[model samples]
Target: MNLIKQYVKEYKNTYIQSVLLAVLGVVSGLAAYIVLAKMIVGLIGKNTEFGFYLQYGLMVLAAMVLKEIFAAASTSISHQATFYSLKKIRQEISKKLFRMPLGNVMNISSGKLKNIIVDQVDSMETILAHIIPEMTANIIGPILLLIYMFILDWRLAIVSLIPLVIGMFCMKSVMASYGKKYQQSVEINQKMNNAVVEYIGGIEVIKMFNQSETSYQKYSEAVHENAAFYYHWMKETMIGVSAYRKISPMSLLTILPLGVYFYLNGSLTIVTFITIIVLSFGTVENILTATNYMDDLSRIGTITKEIGLILDAPDLEHGKENVSLSGSDIELKNVDFSYSEDKKVLEGVSLTIGENQVTAFVGPSGGGKSTITKLIAGFWNADAGEVIIGGKNIKEIPLEQLSETISYVSQDNYLFDMSVRENIRIGKPSASDKEVEEMAKLSGCDEFIRGLSAGYDTIVGEGGGHLSGGEKQRISIARAMLKNAPIVILDEATSYMDT
Candidate 1:
């Protein structure tokens, strides 16, 4: 709950307004119960006045109307605040991702990241929009009613509290293992999501190699595990949950019998007895409604922890001051790097490529060829030693400035679901259409692109799925060429294209 508040402090005034409205709503509802009690007491006393009936009847109607209006207004205001807070949280996550090292970002599963950002963050809407004001009203309304009952007759008030205490005990028993169970569910959900994403993303390969059976088996297994976990968890907790639901709202169990005995003994009046019964039920109703949100409240910690994993991650070390470069030459001195601790991709490696000279590292597969290029591209920071470009350590250069000075095209380049022209324009967002076509011509993609149905206006589809591998490679080349950076590193950038 504190985690949610930290992100929503900017909207405190709006939330307060909502809470005030919610309180008014609860008071209106309680006012209706009071009016009912008055009418019932009047009838019991044989007051046959039509005006008395009409006046109390009208008051009850007015109370109901106000309750609905205040509730609707409060809900609308709360939803607005919740949406704005969610937007702010997502924006912060985006900024954090941009600041983090590409390697760190990649280390996290894409499926898990998506789940946290899209699903887990979205789940907070219930707590923010409904629980905040509603819970406040639920607690306040019941507490106020209980106080009134005490003033009327303290014995009945204590009797009304019996069910609440027992209900809480049952609820506590259910919640004992809730956190662990919910965490397990989250892990299983992530695994299922990952399997589904992988299956969809690799459908082409699966079909071509006739591996559908095995791939489907994995996907189905993950889904089954997710379902089975929830089923067993619910089965285990059903007894306690059922007990709470049945016992919590049954305040009448004690109130009715006790009120009868007190009234029969002449210690309590009929009017007080009936009024306490009515108000006790109302109090129990409010308390039960409030407790209904316990499940959502309990999961706040898990959800926040998932989101914090990304927001709290350590970012790559880089200087903000832009340094002047001596030249365009690149050098790696005593550099050591590894994707994992067990296997060193590059160890104490030194190399230099002079400015205005074409250079390439010839090596077998898995020999850190792409890794070296990526280090120069600032995709990952070296575990040890320094990578220098233009006689300055890369870390000394601002990430944005370093990016602007280098154009890197990897073998597996991704294109957004946008037009081919717009895809190339990503290299230089402000590039003119003519300049884009010029780069396409220079990269030998112009002829083929023009042959397509919509020419350069054609949508590339996700990751250029609409085009062949070779075509996508040429378009990527055009995109990088459009940047016209001083340093260009092509790590098998043309692997798909013919020589």
Candidate 2:
């Protein structure tokens, strides 16, 4: 909740206004109940004047109309503030991703990240836009109404709270281990999400290998496990939930019987007793609405903690200042790295590549060829030793400067869903159309690109899916080539290209 406050603090004034309006709406609703009691008391007292009935009836209508107007305004304002805060949170997460180590970010499941960024952050909308303002009104309104009831008759006021107290016990039981249970729900849901993503992403391979049944079974099992967990969880909590819902709003049960007893004993006046009955109904309605949000409120900790894992992650260390390079030579001194503790991918490895040289690291599959290039490109820091570029340790160079100094093309290069011109221009954002065309020709992408439906302006679908593997590789090459960096590292970059 404190973390969420930090994000929403910028819109504090707007939220305050929303809360104030919501409170006014609650007050108006209470006013309607008071007006109804007054009318009933007048009719019972033998005041059968038509003008009096019409006056109180119009007042009740006006009160209800004002309540709706204030509620609408409050909701509108809160939603605006909430959406702004959500935008800021997402933007911060995006910056956090950029600053984090590539390896660390890649290690996280894509489905989990999507769930946090898209789904989990979206969940905050209810808490911010509706819960905060309206819940505050619900609570404060009941408190204010209770004060009025106590003033009318202290005995009935206390009696009115009996149902509420019992309802609270039921509510407490349901919320006892809510945090732990909600976390388990999140984990189970993530497994289903991951399974669905993997199944769809590998649909092509599944068809090619005739493994649809096996893959589908895995996906189906994950979904069933998630459903089963929720069903059992609801089964366990339903009794407590039902008891709270049934008992909480039954304030009339206690108020009616006790008020009548007091009235029969001449301890309570008829008008006061009747008024207390009407106000009890209003107070109970407000309390029940507020209590209904407890489940959403309880889940806040888990939601924020999930998002916090990404926002609070340590970024990769790099020097802030750019450095002057003596030359383009690269060197690694006794470097080592491993994706996990149990496996050592690179150990005591040393290498040097001279300037203006076409160096090739020839090795069998899984020999750390791609890992070695990634280290030079600053994708991950070497576990044990220093990587040097141009007579300077790579750590001394700022990330921006290091990025500008290297041009890397990997086996699985990604392309945005945009035109060929825009995708190639990403290598050099300010590159003119002619320069892009020239780079395409230099990288051997010109002939095929010109033959496309829209030439260089052709739209490349997501991940360049519209292009063949060979065409995708050539376009990637053109992008890297446009950077015109001193260092170029190609790790199976041409694997998809024609022989």
Q: Pick the candidate with the highest lDDT.
A: 2
- lDDT tens digits by residue: candidate 2, 74-137: 9999999999899989999998887788888997798899889998899999999989899999
Which TM-score value belongs to model 1? 0.95
- The ten-residue window of minimal lDDT in model 1 covers 1-10
Error of 1 at 37 (Å): 1.6
List the candidate 2 regions with Cα displacement exceeding 4 Å.
Answer: none
Clashing pairs in 1: none
**CA lDDT for candidate 2:** 0.92
